[model samples]
Target: MKFAQPWGRQRLSFLLEKAASREAQTWRGYVAKKQTSQDADVSPAQRDEAVRWLTELHGRLQLYPETLVLAVSILDRFLAPIKVRPKYLRCIAVACFFLAAKTCEEDECVPSLKELAASSNCGCSPSEILRMERLILDKLDWDLHTATALDFLHIFHAMATASRSGFLDSIGLNRSQHLGLLTRRLYACLADHALMQLRGSVLALALISLELETCCPDWLALTIDLLRKAQMDSSALIRSRELVSRSLSTPRASLPPNTVYIYHPLQLAAPARRPLGTMETPRDQPALPQAAAGEESKAPPPSPKHLAHLQKVPLRCKASTKRKVEQMDVDDFYDGIKRLYNEDATSAVHEGATPGGGAYSGGSSPCPPLQPVGAS
Candidate 1:
């Protein structure tokens, strides 16, 4: 969504100031030490794994991207001052997630503690998470609201859009679509503990800069303008951009190539019903005579019934196949919309359907169907 004009510039300035002031106070990175050390600390790998776990839970729970960002911010902030044991890291992480949800999410939208614990599978009981939450609150001084990288990202993206107006249009994405893509990339950067050393504003700007460079010819000018406004060091941003670029561009592990075996349910359900040695050939069909060792055997021709059945099959594509293909495309479109909006498109479609589980008929509509925005 585009921010309102006039106030948009002022709001951006205000958020930049607030974030700059709070960034140093909130920024925290843990020392990656061996778990077996006498003073055990959260390792980088463990922290990344925990963040990945939270990311997965965030998608599964359908929580807002803001919630996940805030949760990670909280986790880092809490871990910065306090030295948590490696064993209790999961519990702490889960507690921070819960606390961030309570702070950023609506009262009705926040999941119950019991539900969060069970869903996250963080190896912590609800009571244990409650205890950790209390400890975290005490450590953080009950301040859960902090301007995260995501917050800065929103401000920067809005400012960029406001300045250019038609930049995203050229890229074939509306504001929401582009922002959603950047948000996902930011999430990936957050999972890497290496980028945690950089300030939130610098990291956010670096990501935006990298994206702008690919699409906007005047990306350097925009970057310098944002840097001046944010009061960020150019060198730091450059280093961050390099690190973020490398982190983002790093190849993901793919599954090894293997043949996929598909089994039909009906075949598996009654496997024993058909004896292994049994042949289903009709008795009326005579078997081919045994040929000489060097000769090829001739098989019987098809029966009239079989030929008739084969002739009945259409050569062209079936209507059902076309429908299936159309449905697949429709599903892909809705999936993109769901990623953009984080809404349950399936439930929305179900709600839009008729009571008889059919398409809408000629009548007054209860609600209008969702339309794609700025689709190319």
Candidate 2:
């Protein structure tokens, strides 16, 4: 995670070299050729739509950004080898996303096939996704760890930070924040099929170079060093930088063509209209008393039936007498005992009952009243 470190330079160089080689071997220009023809199997517009779909699913599932980039790479690579119809593009896209999530995310973070299919709403069943997954794996030869543009973006960003510490301090962003901004820009560039012509290393370097020019004073020097390290041509980096700048600057359409907007008004009902030929006169209108008119506007009182429905039902206590006595507080138990003694004393004084009959006497009670025992 430490971007300003010297220990990772060798690893960064190796990653850049691997990504460049794989891109050269696998990347194709099929989108450009099919873009102009309406009957083409997969047009650039369709590919862009598919990529957008994968981006949305990535956010919806809360997967890592790397997963999204890897998914798009898998989709593009799969499309290069096989011709997919526009209708099946979404199914293919979902399959790629599923594969990427399994590869990049932890086992627990990866969604089940049913959940992914249902949540993505790509009009694909779990069976269809499973089948497409097999197809993609076969076509890709089960190699889903290919480096993408995001990988290069990370390398260049780390190298920039390592070269000049606090270069992004002026912008008030830490290394990760600035790198996240660059990652989003790189994702945006990926959505445009036009940038597909550029290799992953070049595209990522272009985005990084664009960001560096704005903040870093030695941006040109830094970019030159990255180009040398990545072994990318300066002309290609220049072209891709222009495309990335334009792509980020341009706003894309937010909604699809088939989108429908629904509106609901707050009014209860519309006022009734008079007949076209009707003429209203003062004498023809009925006169209403002030009290009646005021009453008419007020809400009516609830009926007896509604009042009955609103009444609360009392809950019944189910405790037995012994249970209730066991649960009683000490004060309440002593109070009850004192009341019984007073009642017995009062009865004996009135009726002159004998002490043997469990009555109270003046000098000494027949038997001392029992005291309440505290529970342990």
Candidate 2 lowest-lDDT run of ten: 309-318
lDDT of 2 at 36: 49
How many backbone clashes does every candidate have? Answer: 0, 0
Write the residue-wise lDDT of candidate 2 on 1-376 in tens digits: 2233444778877867777787777666644454544555888878888888777777778788889998998998898866677888899899999898898888999999999989999898999999989999999888887768887788778888888766789899987788888877777788888888887888888888888899989999999999999887889888888888888887583454357779987877843443221122245567666697566333222224433432232322224675444434432543465455443233335243454444444447565554456999
Superposed Cα deviation of residue 52, candidate 1 (Å): 0.3
Q: Across residues 1-376, which tens digit of lDDT does each residue of candidate 1 receive?
A: 2333434688779978988888777666555544566447777777888888788889888878888999998888888765677899899989989988888778998999999998888888999999999999999889887778988998898888888766787899987889898998998898888888887888899989999998888999999999999987889998999999988887541111243668876545532233211223335766444564125312222224423343332222223666556545544654554445434424444335544344443345666654446967
- What local lDDT score does residue 222 receive in model 1, on the 0 to 100 scale? 92
Error of 2 at 275 (Å): 28
Error of 1 at 258 (Å): 16
TM-score of every candidate: 0.64, 0.64
Compared with the true structure, the alpha-carbon lDDT of candidate 1 equals: 0.75
lDDT of each: 0.75, 0.74
lDDT of 2: 0.74
Clashing pairs in 2: none
